[model samples]
Target: MDRKKIVEIISNHYSPLTPECKLDLITNSKLLVLQKGTVLVRGGQFSDKTFFIVNGCARAYYLKDGKDISDWFAFENEFISSINSFFLNIPSPHFIELIEDSVLLEISRGNIEILSNTYHDFERLSKVVAIKTMLKQQERITSMQFHSAEEKYKNLLSIHPDINQRIPLTHIASYINITLETLSRIRKRLTRI
Candidate 1:
Protein backbone atom coordinates (compact mmCIF):
# COMPACT_ATOMS: atom_id res chain seq x y z
CA MET A 1 0.00 0.00 0.00
CA ASP A 2 1.23 3.49 -0.80
CA ARG A 3 1.80 5.40 2.43
CA LYS A 4 1.31 8.73 0.68
CA LYS A 5 -2.05 7.66 -0.74
CA ILE A 6 -3.24 6.38 2.64
CA VAL A 7 -2.19 9.63 4.31
CA GLU A 8 -3.94 11.62 1.59
CA ILE A 9 -7.20 9.69 2.07
CA ILE A 10 -7.24 10.21 5.86
CA SER A 11 -6.25 13.85 5.46
CA ASN A 12 -9.19 14.36 3.12
CA HIS A 13 -11.59 13.18 5.80
CA TYR A 14 -9.87 14.87 8.73
CA SER A 15 -7.54 17.78 8.07
CA PRO A 16 -4.55 18.67 5.93
CA LEU A 17 -1.31 17.69 7.61
CA THR A 18 1.98 19.54 7.54
CA PRO A 19 4.88 18.01 5.62
CA GLU A 20 6.58 17.22 8.93
CA CYS A 21 3.48 15.54 10.41
CA LYS A 22 2.96 13.51 7.24
CA LEU A 23 6.57 12.43 7.32
CA ASP A 24 6.29 11.51 10.99
CA LEU A 25 3.21 9.33 10.31
CA ILE A 26 4.86 7.65 7.34
CA THR A 27 7.94 6.85 9.39
CA ASN A 28 6.29 5.96 12.71
CA SER A 29 3.35 3.91 11.51
CA LYS A 30 3.83 0.37 10.24
CA LEU A 31 2.16 -1.01 7.14
CA LEU A 32 0.46 -4.36 7.66
CA VAL A 33 -1.00 -6.77 5.12
CA LEU A 34 -3.63 -8.97 6.76
CA GLN A 35 -5.24 -12.04 5.28
CA LYS A 36 -8.98 -12.55 5.39
CA GLY A 37 -10.08 -13.89 8.82
CA THR A 38 -7.00 -12.52 10.55
CA VAL A 39 -7.83 -11.14 13.95
CA LEU A 40 -6.15 -7.83 14.63
CA VAL A 41 -7.73 -7.31 18.03
CA ARG A 42 -9.13 -10.11 20.16
CA GLY A 43 -11.63 -9.83 22.96
CA GLY A 44 -9.85 -9.35 26.30
CA GLN A 45 -6.64 -8.31 24.62
CA PHE A 46 -5.00 -5.01 25.40
CA SER A 47 -5.08 -3.08 22.15
CA ASP A 48 -2.69 -0.16 21.81
CA LYS A 49 -2.90 0.44 18.08
CA THR A 50 -5.40 1.82 15.60
CA PHE A 51 -5.56 0.64 12.02
CA PHE A 52 -6.04 2.89 9.03
CA ILE A 53 -7.25 0.68 6.23
CA VAL A 54 -5.59 1.37 2.91
CA ASN A 55 -7.38 -1.47 1.10
CA GLY A 56 -10.04 -4.17 1.62
CA CYS A 57 -12.25 -4.38 4.71
CA ALA A 58 -12.55 -5.32 8.39
CA ARG A 59 -15.26 -5.75 11.01
CA ALA A 60 -15.56 -5.24 14.74
CA TYR A 61 -17.59 -7.88 16.57
CA TYR A 62 -18.56 -9.07 20.01
CA LEU A 63 -19.48 -12.50 21.21
CA LYS A 64 -22.97 -12.80 22.63
CA ASP A 65 -24.31 -16.18 23.79
CA GLY A 66 -21.60 -17.87 21.71
CA LYS A 67 -22.57 -16.00 18.56
CA ASP A 68 -20.51 -13.26 16.93
CA ILE A 69 -22.45 -10.05 16.66
CA SER A 70 -20.97 -7.64 14.18
CA ASP A 71 -20.94 -4.09 15.45
CA TRP A 72 -19.45 -2.19 12.53
CA PHE A 73 -17.41 -2.49 9.35
CA ALA A 74 -14.50 -0.43 8.10
CA PHE A 75 -13.42 -0.43 4.49
CA GLU A 76 -10.70 1.23 2.55
CA ASN A 77 -9.81 4.78 3.60
CA GLU A 78 -11.39 4.25 7.03
CA PHE A 79 -10.12 3.70 10.56
CA ILE A 80 -10.64 0.62 12.74
CA SER A 81 -9.76 0.20 16.39
CA SER A 82 -11.06 -1.05 19.69
CA ILE A 83 -12.10 2.44 20.67
CA ASN A 84 -13.07 1.66 24.27
CA SER A 85 -9.91 -0.27 25.05
CA PHE A 86 -7.60 1.98 23.07
CA PHE A 87 -8.84 5.05 24.87
CA LEU A 88 -9.13 3.52 28.33
CA ASN A 89 -5.92 1.52 28.14
CA ILE A 90 -7.69 -1.68 29.08
CA PRO A 91 -8.49 -5.04 27.53
CA SER A 92 -11.05 -4.88 24.73
CA PRO A 93 -14.50 -6.44 24.65
CA HIS A 94 -14.64 -6.31 20.87
CA PHE A 95 -12.63 -8.25 18.34
CA ILE A 96 -11.44 -6.75 15.05
CA GLU A 97 -10.99 -9.07 12.07
CA LEU A 98 -10.10 -8.65 8.47
CA ILE A 99 -13.08 -9.64 6.34
CA GLU A 100 -11.09 -9.33 3.12
CA ASP A 101 -7.35 -9.34 2.53
CA SER A 102 -6.40 -5.89 3.77
CA VAL A 103 -3.53 -3.48 3.95
CA LEU A 104 -3.45 -1.13 6.93
CA LEU A 105 -1.28 1.51 8.47
CA GLU A 106 -0.94 0.70 12.17
CA ILE A 107 -0.35 3.61 14.54
CA SER A 108 0.37 2.89 18.16
CA ARG A 109 -1.26 4.95 20.91
CA GLY A 110 2.10 6.39 21.93
CA ASN A 111 2.83 7.58 18.44
CA ILE A 112 -0.63 9.10 18.18
CA GLU A 113 -0.04 10.97 21.44
CA ILE A 114 3.30 12.19 20.14
CA LEU A 115 1.66 13.45 16.96
CA SER A 116 -1.12 15.14 18.93
CA ASN A 117 1.42 16.91 21.06
CA THR A 118 3.66 17.91 18.18
CA TYR A 119 1.01 19.01 15.69
CA HIS A 120 -2.07 21.12 16.37
CA ASP A 121 -3.67 19.93 13.10
CA PHE A 122 -3.28 16.32 14.21
CA GLU A 123 -5.15 17.05 17.44
CA ARG A 124 -7.98 18.68 15.50
CA LEU A 125 -8.11 15.75 13.11
CA SER A 126 -8.27 13.33 16.04
CA LYS A 127 -11.19 15.22 17.57
CA VAL A 128 -13.06 15.23 14.25
CA VAL A 129 -12.55 11.51 13.83
CA ALA A 130 -13.75 10.83 17.38
CA ILE A 131 -16.87 12.92 16.88
CA LYS A 132 -17.67 11.31 13.54
CA THR A 133 -17.28 7.85 14.97
CA MET A 134 -19.54 8.62 17.91
CA LEU A 135 -22.18 10.16 15.65
CA LYS A 136 -22.22 7.15 13.35
CA GLN A 137 -22.63 4.82 16.32
CA GLN A 138 -25.48 6.91 17.68
CA GLU A 139 -27.18 6.92 14.27
CA ARG A 140 -27.00 3.16 14.07
CA ILE A 141 -28.46 2.80 17.55
CA THR A 142 -31.27 5.24 16.71
CA SER A 143 -32.06 3.45 13.46
CA MET A 144 -32.35 0.11 15.20
CA GLN A 145 -34.63 1.58 17.83
CA PHE A 146 -36.93 3.49 15.49
CA HIS A 147 -36.86 1.75 12.08
CA SER A 148 -38.39 -1.44 10.77
CA ALA A 149 -36.13 -4.16 9.37
CA GLU A 150 -36.94 -3.26 5.81
CA GLU A 151 -36.51 0.42 6.52
CA LYS A 152 -33.15 -0.27 8.18
CA TYR A 153 -31.99 -2.26 5.18
CA LYS A 154 -33.13 0.43 2.79
CA ASN A 155 -31.47 3.17 4.80
CA LEU A 156 -28.22 1.20 4.99
CA LEU A 157 -28.26 0.75 1.24
CA SER A 158 -29.07 4.40 0.74
CA ILE A 159 -26.02 5.41 2.77
CA HIS A 160 -23.67 2.61 1.70
CA PRO A 161 -24.84 1.47 -1.70
CA ASP A 162 -21.93 -0.94 -2.21
CA ILE A 163 -22.32 -2.67 1.20
CA ASN A 164 -24.46 -5.52 -0.14
CA GLN A 165 -21.84 -6.20 -2.80
CA ARG A 166 -18.88 -6.00 -0.45
CA ILE A 167 -20.07 -7.69 2.75
CA PRO A 168 -21.69 -11.07 3.29
CA LEU A 169 -25.45 -11.08 3.76
CA THR A 170 -25.24 -12.87 7.09
CA HIS A 171 -22.84 -10.28 8.55
CA ILE A 172 -25.02 -7.46 7.28
CA ALA A 173 -28.05 -9.15 8.80
CA SER A 174 -26.26 -9.45 12.11
CA TYR A 175 -25.26 -5.81 12.02
CA ILE A 176 -28.83 -4.74 11.37
CA ASN A 177 -30.27 -7.19 13.98
CA ILE A 178 -32.29 -9.20 11.48
CA THR A 179 -32.31 -12.84 10.49
CA LEU A 180 -30.80 -13.87 7.18
CA GLU A 181 -34.16 -15.14 5.90
CA THR A 182 -35.79 -11.80 6.80
CA LEU A 183 -32.98 -9.92 5.09
CA SER A 184 -33.42 -12.06 1.97
CA ARG A 185 -37.12 -11.32 1.95
CA ILE A 186 -36.44 -7.64 2.37
CA ARG A 187 -34.01 -7.68 -0.53
CA LYS A 188 -36.52 -9.49 -2.74
CA ARG A 189 -39.25 -7.07 -1.77
CA LEU A 190 -36.95 -4.12 -2.43
CA THR A 191 -36.20 -5.40 -5.92
CA ARG A 192 -39.86 -5.72 -6.81
CA ILE A 193 -40.76 -2.28 -5.43
Candidate 2:
Protein backbone atom coordinates (compact mmCIF):
# COMPACT_ATOMS: atom_id res chain seq x y z
CA MET A 1 0.00 0.00 0.00
CA ASP A 2 1.10 3.54 -0.72
CA ARG A 3 1.73 6.29 1.88
CA LYS A 4 -1.17 8.41 0.61
CA LYS A 5 -3.64 5.57 1.04
CA ILE A 6 -2.48 4.90 4.56
CA VAL A 7 -2.82 8.57 5.50
CA GLU A 8 -6.27 8.69 3.91
CA ILE A 9 -7.39 5.63 5.84
CA ILE A 10 -6.12 7.06 9.14
CA SER A 11 -7.85 10.38 8.48
CA ASN A 12 -11.11 8.68 7.51
CA HIS A 13 -11.14 6.34 10.49
CA TYR A 14 -10.15 8.80 13.17
CA SER A 15 -9.51 12.47 12.50
CA PRO A 16 -7.74 14.30 9.75
CA LEU A 17 -3.98 14.40 10.17
CA THR A 18 -1.72 17.39 9.70
CA PRO A 19 0.80 17.25 6.86
CA GLU A 20 3.56 16.67 9.40
CA CYS A 21 1.56 14.10 11.34
CA LYS A 22 0.84 12.28 8.10
CA LEU A 23 4.53 12.16 7.25
CA ASP A 24 5.43 10.96 10.72
CA LEU A 25 2.85 8.16 10.60
CA ILE A 26 3.98 7.10 7.17
CA THR A 27 7.52 6.95 8.36
CA ASN A 28 6.74 5.13 11.60
CA SER A 29 4.09 2.61 10.56
CA LYS A 30 5.05 -0.66 8.88
CA LEU A 31 3.00 -2.17 6.08
CA LEU A 32 2.26 -5.83 6.69
CA VAL A 33 0.87 -8.54 4.47
CA LEU A 34 -0.18 -11.50 6.56
CA GLN A 35 -2.02 -14.69 5.75
CA LYS A 36 -5.05 -16.16 7.40
CA GLY A 37 -4.58 -17.60 10.89
CA THR A 38 -1.57 -15.42 11.66
CA VAL A 39 -1.50 -14.73 15.38
CA LEU A 40 -0.08 -11.25 15.84
CA VAL A 41 -0.39 -11.29 19.61
CA ARG A 42 -0.89 -14.32 21.77
CA GLY A 43 -2.42 -14.60 25.18
CA GLY A 44 0.05 -13.68 27.91
CA GLN A 45 2.35 -11.86 25.51
CA PHE A 46 3.20 -8.21 25.95
CA SER A 47 2.27 -6.55 22.68
CA ASP A 48 2.62 -2.87 21.90
CA LYS A 49 1.76 -3.20 18.22
CA THR A 50 -1.57 -1.93 16.93
CA PHE A 51 -2.87 -2.69 13.47
CA PHE A 52 -5.08 -0.85 11.05
CA ILE A 53 -6.63 -3.22 8.56
CA VAL A 54 -6.16 -1.96 5.07
CA ASN A 55 -7.92 -5.10 3.87
CA GLY A 56 -9.33 -8.33 5.36
CA CYS A 57 -10.34 -9.14 8.94
CA ALA A 58 -8.98 -9.94 12.41
CA ARG A 59 -10.42 -10.86 15.80
CA ALA A 60 -9.35 -10.69 19.43
CA TYR A 61 -10.35 -13.82 21.26
CA TYR A 62 -9.65 -15.74 24.43
CA LEU A 63 -9.29 -19.40 25.16
CA LYS A 64 -11.32 -20.33 28.23
CA ASP A 65 -11.97 -23.82 29.53
CA GLY A 66 -10.79 -25.16 26.16
CA LYS A 67 -13.28 -23.09 24.22
CA ASP A 68 -12.42 -20.13 22.04
CA ILE A 69 -14.50 -17.03 22.61
CA SER A 70 -14.25 -13.93 20.50
CA ASP A 71 -14.37 -10.53 22.10
CA TRP A 72 -13.78 -8.13 19.24
CA PHE A 73 -13.35 -7.99 15.48
CA ALA A 74 -11.83 -5.47 13.08
CA PHE A 75 -12.31 -5.41 9.34
CA GLU A 76 -11.35 -3.14 6.53
CA ASN A 77 -10.67 0.38 7.81
CA GLU A 78 -10.87 -0.79 11.41
CA PHE A 79 -8.19 -1.07 14.10
CA ILE A 80 -7.29 -3.97 16.39
CA SER A 81 -4.84 -4.42 19.23
CA SER A 82 -4.33 -6.21 22.47
CA ILE A 83 -5.80 -3.25 24.28
CA ASN A 84 -4.79 -4.11 27.84
CA SER A 85 -1.26 -4.99 26.85
CA PHE A 86 -0.97 -2.00 24.58
CA PHE A 87 -2.15 0.50 27.16
CA LEU A 88 -1.23 -0.99 30.53
CA ASN A 89 2.13 -2.46 29.48
CA ILE A 90 0.97 -5.85 30.70
CA PRO A 91 0.53 -9.24 29.09
CA SER A 92 -2.48 -9.58 26.83
CA PRO A 93 -5.32 -11.75 28.05
CA HIS A 94 -6.55 -12.43 24.55
CA PHE A 95 -5.12 -13.35 21.16
CA ILE A 96 -5.15 -11.21 18.04
CA GLU A 97 -5.45 -13.31 14.87
CA LEU A 98 -5.99 -12.56 11.25
CA ILE A 99 -9.06 -14.28 9.80
CA GLU A 100 -8.02 -13.76 6.21
CA ASP A 101 -5.01 -12.79 4.13
CA SER A 102 -4.66 -9.19 5.15
CA VAL A 103 -2.89 -5.98 4.39
CA LEU A 104 -2.28 -3.90 7.51
CA LEU A 105 -0.50 -0.83 8.79
CA GLU A 106 1.25 -1.59 12.05
CA ILE A 107 2.44 1.10 14.43
CA SER A 108 4.28 0.60 17.70
CA ARG A 109 3.29 2.10 21.05
CA GLY A 110 6.40 4.27 21.13
CA ASN A 111 5.52 5.77 17.77
CA ILE A 112 1.98 6.42 18.91
CA GLU A 113 3.28 8.18 22.02
CA ILE A 114 5.69 10.31 20.07
CA LEU A 115 3.12 11.28 17.49
CA SER A 116 0.47 11.99 20.10
CA ASN A 117 2.87 14.14 22.10
CA THR A 118 4.13 16.08 19.12
CA TYR A 119 0.95 16.54 17.15
CA HIS A 120 -2.41 17.76 18.37
CA ASP A 121 -4.09 16.07 15.45
CA PHE A 122 -2.53 12.72 16.32
CA GLU A 123 -3.66 13.06 19.93
CA ARG A 124 -7.18 13.82 18.81
CA LEU A 125 -7.10 10.89 16.44
CA SER A 126 -5.97 8.55 19.19
CA LYS A 127 -8.69 9.79 21.51
CA VAL A 128 -11.35 9.35 18.85
CA VAL A 129 -10.23 5.83 18.04
CA ALA A 130 -10.08 4.82 21.70
CA ILE A 131 -13.54 6.19 22.37
CA LYS A 132 -14.94 4.37 19.38
CA THR A 133 -13.41 1.08 20.46
CA MET A 134 -14.70 1.50 23.99
CA LEU A 135 -18.19 2.25 22.75
CA LYS A 136 -18.16 -0.85 20.59
CA GLN A 137 -17.22 -2.97 23.59
CA GLN A 138 -20.03 -1.37 25.59
CA GLU A 139 -22.51 -2.12 22.86
CA ARG A 140 -21.43 -5.76 22.79
CA ILE A 141 -21.84 -6.04 26.54
CA THR A 142 -25.32 -4.55 26.40
CA SER A 143 -26.36 -6.85 23.62
CA MET A 144 -25.12 -9.92 25.43
CA GLN A 145 -26.77 -8.90 28.68
CA PHE A 146 -30.23 -7.99 27.43
CA HIS A 147 -30.87 -9.22 23.91
CA SER A 148 -32.38 -12.57 23.12
CA ALA A 149 -30.52 -14.94 20.84
CA GLU A 150 -32.56 -13.89 17.84
CA GLU A 151 -32.38 -10.25 18.77
CA LYS A 152 -28.65 -10.45 19.26
CA TYR A 153 -28.19 -12.12 15.91
CA LYS A 154 -30.34 -9.51 14.22
CA ASN A 155 -28.49 -6.66 15.88
CA LEU A 156 -25.17 -8.12 14.79
CA LEU A 157 -26.46 -8.52 11.28
CA SER A 158 -27.58 -4.91 11.28
CA ILE A 159 -24.10 -3.76 12.15
CA HIS A 160 -22.39 -6.17 9.79
CA PRO A 161 -24.64 -7.51 7.11
CA ASP A 162 -21.94 -9.47 5.35
CA ILE A 163 -20.34 -10.79 8.51
CA ASN A 164 -21.55 -14.31 7.87
CA GLN A 165 -19.76 -14.25 4.58
CA ARG A 166 -16.58 -12.80 6.03
CA ILE A 167 -16.27 -14.52 9.42
CA PRO A 168 -16.86 -18.03 10.67
CA LEU A 169 -20.23 -18.70 12.28
CA THR A 170 -18.67 -20.33 15.32
CA HIS A 171 -16.73 -17.20 16.11
CA ILE A 172 -19.83 -15.08 15.61
CA ALA A 173 -21.81 -17.37 17.91
CA SER A 174 -19.17 -17.13 20.59
CA TYR A 175 -18.92 -13.38 20.29
CA ILE A 176 -22.68 -13.06 20.84
CA ASN A 177 -22.65 -15.67 23.64
CA ILE A 178 -24.77 -18.16 21.73
CA THR A 179 -24.31 -21.80 20.89
CA LEU A 180 -23.74 -22.77 17.29
CA GLU A 181 -27.10 -24.57 17.20
CA THR A 182 -28.90 -21.50 18.49
CA LEU A 183 -27.24 -19.30 15.92
CA SER A 184 -28.14 -21.73 13.15
CA ARG A 185 -31.75 -21.82 14.25
CA ILE A 186 -31.87 -18.05 14.42
CA ARG A 187 -30.42 -17.74 10.97
CA LYS A 188 -32.91 -20.21 9.56
CA ARG A 189 -35.84 -18.54 11.28
CA LEU A 190 -34.80 -15.13 10.06
CA THR A 191 -34.38 -16.38 6.52
CA ARG A 192 -37.87 -17.89 6.52
CA ILE A 193 -39.34 -14.69 7.90
Index of the highest-lDDT prediction: 2
Instruction: Put down candidate 2 lDDT per residue, 1-193, tens digits, no spaces.
Output: 7867877888976899988889999999999999999999999999999999999999999999999999998998888999999999999999999999999999999999999999999999999999999999999999989989998889999999999999999999999999999999999988898
Q: What's the alpha carbon RMSD for model 1?
A: 1.0
For model 1, state the Cα shift of residue 137 in Å: 0.7
User: Best-fitting candidate, measured by TM-score?
Assistant: 2
Residue lDDT tens for model 1, 1-193? 5787788778887788888888888888888987999999999999999998888899999998999899999887778899989999999999999999999999999999999999998888888888878988899999999999998998899988999888899999999999999999999988898
Q: In candidate 2, which residue ranges exceed 4 Å CA deviation?
A: none
Question: Which lDDT values do the candidates have, in the order given?
Answer: 0.91, 0.93
Please, what is the TM-score per model? 0.96, 0.98
